[model samples]
Target chain A: MKSNEVRVARFDGYERVMHWMAALSFLYAALTGLAIWSPVLYWMAALSGGGFVIRGTHPWSGVLFTAVIGWMFARWAKTMGLDADDRVWLTRMDKYATHQHDALPESGKFNAGQKMLFWSQVVTALLLMVSGVVLWFPEWMPRSLRLVAIAMHPLAAIGSIAGIIVHIYMGTMSVPRSMRAMLLGWVTPNWARLHHPKWYREWRGSTNLR
Target chain B: MLVAKLIDTTLCIGCKACEVACQEWNDQEYTLGTFNGSYQTMPDLAPNFWNLIKFNEVQRNGAEAWLMSKYQCMHCADAGCLAACPAPGAITQLANGTVDFVHENCIGCGYCITGCPFDVPKLSPASKKVYKCSLCSDRTAVGLEPACIKTCPTNCLTFGERDEMIRVAEIRTRELKADGFKDAGIYNPAGVGGTNVIYVLNDAKQPEQYGLPKDPIIPWTVQLWKGPLKALGAMVFMGSILGAFFHYVVFGPQQEEAADEVE
Candidate 1:
């Protein structure tokens, strides 16, 4: 093998762009939303321009975030689906968390924990969008529906936010060097094989890059 | 004295002089509309019409009754609009208990409309801001009564300090009760810490009939859930960091894959 050939195509450029768009917008929406949600954090409102800007931008960015999530769901839903092995991986989430890879189930492109995060976020994002529209122009909505929407918006937001925290941490921190795939749309061949051996084997047998 | 208004629904002649006075004083025109076979004009509050008279007819024991109410903001001690507003200074609860708006500070996010139990504020697409009766803050600030109060021929709408207004409303309520109106009562909802603008309703037992909420509390979830959710966000953020640290300390990061076939 050539020493220069150190990379594997883990994500295409378009996929990486969609991923960054989702990540960046989700962060903005979460931050601006937090600023609007709590008076103590109102000072953070300046990050989105101002208090009014937070109110206005938060919902719109939420819409953008949902769209990106929708695109992500379309792209990855098949790969992220749960099977018997996924259930096993979830049952042994403790092993994965502690990097007991030998004890961990043979993961595909995404592990069970990642699948769980994806599905939870998808549900939460859809709920947020539906509830956000109710809150967006509540002047026209009946009082009862608006009240429910107002209450549920936060609940869904809380779930998605916490899930996202774990997701970002897992993607970038828990498994070190994992962000190379997301950042530059490639991972070291070694990184791919270690994290996703099944994918590596499939790719190795199908194509010879060099 | 801090300003307040008394809206005696029993005394309201449904003259709509106050409505006209409101439009005149504010220098505004109302939305175009055709009569919907009801005396109730424009259906509900709008940007143009800050004040409105709601009409209701009921058949009570072989007699037809036409009930009228001067519907507007209650200007509560704990205003829902102020609580739900995300934009700073967009909605203000004055020292006098008059809830007003600083339009320049308002961003057209309709949370206030949902927050308001009375359904007072309306979004004006033209101005792209919520507008409602500011309790004539401009006139009251100058020591003049609101245009609505000034033009009320029956002397129904009165303005004064908050305590005095409540006192007057209580007395009126007693007189109506003695007059054999069994349900006559004051409509200063206690749930919102009582409103500056009290109402002497001939039949307060059914505020819903007059399009007023029987219990006008500020939307509780908006206020209640915020603190817990904020705490949750902080905890989750910390948990992510801690979880990662613990995983790394234990596993020391996955080694570069030694499988050289792919590499």
Candidate 2:
């Protein structure tokens, strides 16, 4: 919007709030999880008022995270669904890393990589919630099952965290103005046209049909 | 002064007096409850109650059998609870092979609970600290036996040097074997460097029936995830940062929307 006279909406108020809530919950869960998983990261326990609080608070944070992510999935699952173009876009990662947008596929509301992150989060979030619940009150389940869940929770956390790192980089640097779109709920027509031309065409109904 | 205990289950009369003495000695107030089909008062261990007498009533070839096993911390030589403890001075291993918990130092993380192969440590909601059978180090340091051992009426529970206790347990095992109990053996499982407390069980084949693991070892999941996977996670994290840095060095800043490109 600052770059152009016309302001096009990207994220709604509900989407922005949900995103921040998810982000905060994710960060707290990750920190607490790391603090519990190994002693080397035990200093993180101090950040959350010592190891006991971190240990006790982590499962609840995971509950909040799962709830928020569930809501986000309900809202964004359709728009983020992958298609043939998205699959093709996956093959051109070198071009993407090098910033060759001209060689990339025309994207919809979300690009191929964003769609991958969306699906990855969908799976990881569910796995983490299930494993976290089993680990929280392990006595509720059999010891054999609890041991399996204990092994699973950290690996799920690792996966979601790695995806999130790439997502943050993509939003901030790889695709500049994406964070602004999420923050302000709008992007300039120029940004839309250059980054997501097919979406811009759909929104503006412009004469440049190509 | 490293102490150990020998529990002869064959001589145990299934009396809950040791359980009562443990509660009184530790000053842990647990609600008295109705019998839940078995003589055992409580179903499992609690933060307040550091000891338990698990009663298992199983039938063998149409004959009634009663199994009563006293349950408490095993206090291993290679303690996973101590290995997983993040706080310094929270858990200490004595020269006498007594693994002790310092409540003041416990940050109430419950990591010790999961770290334990025996499910011994319990976290209290009130104090937010982990508690377990201390092996009565408070009494042992003053040259007194543990309350449980002292209160055992049949003299089934005895305390002495850890090495001597093992020999006593072996002797009991031989006696049980001669008495027509073919499966008799000492339960000082070597999977965790053997336990400080030894058990001479009549039927050692099914330790699980007495709420004990047949082959207890520190969980492999804890070992790999906390040990090697951690380093790999750090590498992946640092790799991302370095990837970003090198991208900047190679490709420079990404191009934004061009001034001339318009709808």
Candidate 3:
């Protein structure tokens, strides 16, 4: 809370906007899709504006999510790649999960776990999109293709949903100030130094800060 | 007492009366006649047109012979449409053994179309709802035979108890066999748990010639997808969410160190 405290820029405005767009569309698609997947969750259709509205809107929301994720992939794929340090950090993920952050290697802007979450989402988003298209236009597809899609869509959805659950938990609960970084596009220098020391050092080096 | 309809293909004169009667009784929109180089009304059933009399020209004793059968929803006891439908109550197997589609709940996803082994259900382009034969559930509920069975001039279509219909079909099949139809048999396909709408085909061995699958079954892939795979997906979903909740409880958020604060 000091007035002289330094603020490190984490995410830009454009990145934060794209991230939220993806999050919202993903939530919409997931809820509606679950409504259609099981009788137990059939009541969810009412939450998503009923079965009729969801049938018309769910696929389109999936398209929007895929498009946004694709954009994020293009913008972040290079920096999100796994390096030697990230591989070592992956081995010590238990320490990272248990709040023993100092036991793990210094992380970059994104840690190994975060990068894994990003890549898994992108892969599953593409899977959902392809299978979703097959389901959206059943008449155009053959029986064999339809069979594969009917199974693939939900399986891929499970993958992405699992990743997002962890992503939300980590951003909001496990790590402090991480939500603020995506929300306001900056984090306190102490937060950066504790969580992503390598990135913090790079920012200091670039800015000539002691 | 499960009700059923038995169609005797041998007795059918290809009069097309039952087809017209079904259209009239159901109050379905009239489909325009299209010639496809044969007396067969339409190549296949339409969303609006629920019933059709398929005309097949096959070689019998080196001579061309016509094979006809009334084609509509088989109303399978284990209907794939009911099994594949994600929208609860959209497709249901009625107490009287009729599989009906509730138009109101239909999301028009066409999963039923994919699920159906007989390819009976059709999605309407205009309303985006699926349509098929309800076996005159409205009429049968009132203790009356289906419109198709009532209107059949040749008495080819008969409606009664499931066991009685099967017994009648067996007798007719035996008679056809005696008349030199060696392949004549009942077409109630046990693979689908026997259809409420059974058939007595003259050439049961060659049912594909009558536009019916030789051995109709709900694809195993569809069964797995709607069954165990769905359960697996639900488990994974619950596991992830619960895991996150418990992890948060056990290990609190990684708090920022006080010493890291700059003076």
Candidate 4:
């Protein structure tokens, strides 16, 4: 955070804004959904509006999140794809978890774990949207389909919520400069070189061209 | 005393007086009945129209027989609507076996509709709240019979203690069997742990002919979703948080090593 530190561009301003939109909407929808999922968590409804209001607005929030996710997929799908290096990184995940980062493959813009998070989020979001629509308009669907949706919606929600919890924990606690990159769209060259050597090298090459 | 209503289908004349009384007492809007080629009025129960008389014409021994029966919430002892409802106290089973809907607490999610084995709960399009028969808890709490029972002129609908009502229904079933209804029996389906509304059917072998399910049970999907599925989801949610916390405590934050930084 020194003023004289050499900084490298990570996320752009538009990407940061889009990420916040996705995060906020996802949190709202997940909270409201949890409120309506069980009476034990019914108290969560009081935190937002009431039970009826949460029930009504939860699906709309889900729609907003799905829209943001679509934007993210279009923007980052190319970089987020898994490759040979990512597979190598995945195999060395135990080392990564144990802070043996030197043993893992060089990371690019996103690490293997981040790519996995992105893909899992995409899958769970798709499940939520389809099942959410079915639940919202139950009268339009057959009982069998509705039954499947009622079950699928919660399962997908559980998956996404748990994944996001880990994402949040990693972003804010486990890694230091990750949140700053998402917030200010910049990270120090040393930080990037330490965490994502391939990305730092690519940025250095692009800057040298200019 | 667990109060109940015993409906003797043999004594019913398909007059629908109980339905009329129910509408009048509940102050529901007057709905025009279409000619569905039957004496029965509406196709099914509506949010406002809680009680109904279903008329089913069946061929028995090559003779046309009309099976007329009053239909409403069964008020099961193990009420599925109450079980599946996420909104606390929105749907509750009273001490007298009446399943009541507190519309104020209703989130209008329609989970009750899916949970109900009888498909009794209907979501009101206007209010967005689910509604069903209250078994006239208001009147019964004040020592008065339900409007439907009081208005039934043929003594077909009778209200009393649950045990006494079952006894009365058993007697009626015996009398019906003696009078050539060989399959006459009482219907208080045990699948839902019996119901406050018991019926003495002339042809109990085919309750479906009376517009009643032979083996009505809470949908297994709802049971699984609200029961073990909910428990599993909670466990996973907590497990993830605790796992993250324990990881943070054990390995600490993965900070950058000073030697790795090339300033």
Worst 10 residues of 1 chain A by lDDT: A1-10
| Best-performing candidate as measured by TM-score | 3
TM-score of 4: 0.95
Q: How large is the C-alpha RMSD of every model relative to the true structure?
A: 2.6, 3.0, 1.9, 2.2
At residue B42, candidate 3 shows an lDDT of 90
Query: Residue by residue across A69-90, what tens digits does model 4's lDDT show?
Result: 9999999999999989999999
DockQ of each: 0.54, 0.42, 0.62, 0.51
Error of 1 at A135 (Å): 1.5
Per-residue alpha-carbon lDDT of candidate 2 for residues B10-99, written as tens digits (9 for 90 to 100) = 888888888989999988887676668878878878888888888888776598888889899998987878866667678999999899
The per-prediction tally of clashing pairs is 0, 1, 0, 0
Error of 2 at A159 (Å): 1.1
Off by over 4 Å in 3: A1-4, B59-65, B257-263
Backbone clash total, candidate 4: 0
For model 4, what is the C-alpha lDDT against the true structure?
0.88
Off by over 4 Å in 2: A1-3, A206-210, B60-62, B80-92, B104-117, B123-129, B179-182, B208-211
The 10-residue segment with the lowest total lDDT in model 3 chain A: A1-10
What ranking emerges by DockQ with the best candidate at the front? 3, 1, 4, 2
Give each candidate's interface RMSD in Å. 2.9, 3.1, 2.5, 3.1
Cα lDDT of model 2 by residue, A1-210, tens digit? 234766778889999999989999999999888777666777877898876676678888989989998999999998988788888899997888888878889888788888888889989999999877777764455566666776678788888888887777777776777889988899888888777777887887743323
TM-score of 1: 0.91
Cα misplacement distance, residue A1 of candidate 2 (Å): 13
Candidate 3 lDDT tens digits, A1-210: 441277778999999999999999999999999899888888999987789789999999999999999999999999999999999999998888788877888889999999999999999999999989999987668878888888888888888888898899888988876888999998877777777889978886787555
For candidate 3, give the lDDT of residue B203: 88
Could you tell me which residue pairs clash in candidate 2? B2-B96
